[model samples]
Target: MIDSKQKGMIFNVQKFSVHDGAGIRTLVFLKGCPLRCRWCSNPESQLFKPERAYNPNRCLTAEVCGRCAKACNEGGVTLIDGLICFDRSKCTDCGSCVNACPTGSQTVYGYEMTVGEIIKKVEEDDVFYSRSGGGLTLSGGEALAQPEFSLALLREAKRHRLATAIETCGVYPTEVLAEACKYLDELIFDIKHLDDEKHKKFTGGSNEQILKNIQYVFENFPSLPVTVRTPVIPGFNDTEEEIMAIRRFVPLRDNVQYEVLTYHRLGSPKYGYLGRPYLLGDVKADDDFMRQIRAKLREYQG
Candidate 1:
């Protein structure tokens, strides 16, 4: 029996998202990822452990409120020139400051929630789902990283009679992915690069298995609708040759489809929150470049 209290770590549950699937969907952002793509927008989701994040703008300042420093177990929280300085190295991620803060300046990312808790949140948009063919999506630092929790969650989503989808990095073991696929209605897999060497340089993992898994998944579930998405990063996979290789390799002739995701700076701030430097500084996927790529890929249908 699936444990009613089986828990998973998640950072956010975005509702009414139209981009993830066939209709509006509730996107559950799971925490922890295996890949370290430098251009990754959600840098906060990469770590498996729940972490503390402080926003100086939201802080009430140490002069007015010295509560966070008092709550620190490792003395990780300190005041410097009336400003709060969080020493992450000394910290253990116990969430003491996060709980003690008054102005919401101190915060923690990722928390454990059971399948029942998550389903309750997903059910909130059921009215919208029924009216617009919307449902739920499991996304993450790689949803399959938490295999058992994800399977249980997706199983419950199916029980609720909701359309389900998964956004994966395609790096997990094939059996783990294959089992999750049984519960997913649509698979949105990302192919970062076609070349294994460049793939390792960018994402810290070779695309050898990612490429093989793509074929394995398609062959195993031929009827399942698949969308292969590629995030076009500048100075990485931006060339016409690279993009074209991806477009051609991902078969759109059948149930499979291809998408060229334009890069953005949205996740850069999250890097600062974690006291890490943004790797892809000032990088963006130009609209014209993406437009041409989209047009070229669409020629396949004709």
Candidate 2:
């Protein structure tokens, strides 16, 4: 077993994130995820291991030779028409090619970092958190998937008197959820769909455990501020009935709020970079639709 110091893998430490949680927050994106949501914005966070990404638009080549190809040990890179052609299957994610690429075309996602390392980085923005009522937010493929690491990070964040929040899919065991919640000041639980079958079909998991965990948190920990966010996808779950059904599931707690996150194509470029096919293409819900959905949700207000 790995020691407590060698806990979780983090993909990105996004600072001054305003839309994820309350105030200007630092979102510590943890690696590894159980669900394979078709419309995931951060596909890079899905895998546990470091994966290579290529931004074709960022590539720059002149009369130079193939330096990147020589840097890679797997022979995964080849120059095609003076442009780099990366073979995803043969790549080993050593980040040698990324380092060799002078123009910064090649990049890798995900990095293994200890809890102490993360805390040190997060502590850099203590002034921002203090001024804006913001702090660290643990988000990921699924933060609860790495329970021990998340719990330790939360505990340390609390030790520093920072407000903590977690963006979870609520698919983990009840015990793990409870322990993580002990240190978090807020919980941002995601409710993708109301119907169990649709939830499983889209998110690669059933809503049974997700629902149970949310209900448990609401019923038991009334003081824990909970915000339920649903990413309103186009074909999957953008209907009025689906949104209202999610609103109905919100517990009758005083400290809870429901949010409808309209879908956007911001992550489509990521699929190309990751060498994955884009599932949701050119599909987006407009502001009018989001406002309409938000208005409908108000009908369910207690």
Top candidate (TM-score): 1
Writing each residue's lDDT as its tens digit, candidate 2 over 1-302 gives: 33337568888999999977788899999988989898898999888877789887777653464568878889788777867789988888778888988776888888788887888888899999889989999999898898888888888778778899999999889999988889988999998987889888878889898999998998778899999999999888877887887888786567899888878888878999998987766777777878888887776684
Q: In candidate 2, how many clashes are counted?
A: 0
Best by lDDT: 1
What lDDT does candidate 1 reach at residue 154? 91
Q: How much does candidate 2 score in TM-score?
A: 0.94
Once fitted onto the true fold, the runs of candidate 1 whose alpha carbons sit more than 4 angstroms away are 1-3
Estimated TM-score for each candidate: 0.94, 0.94
Q: Candidates' lDDT values, in order?
A: 0.87, 0.85
Predict model 2's lDDT versus the native: 0.85
The superposed Cα distance between candidate 2 and the true structure at residue 30, in angstroms, equals 0.6
State how far residue 226 of model 1 sits from its true place (Å).
1.0
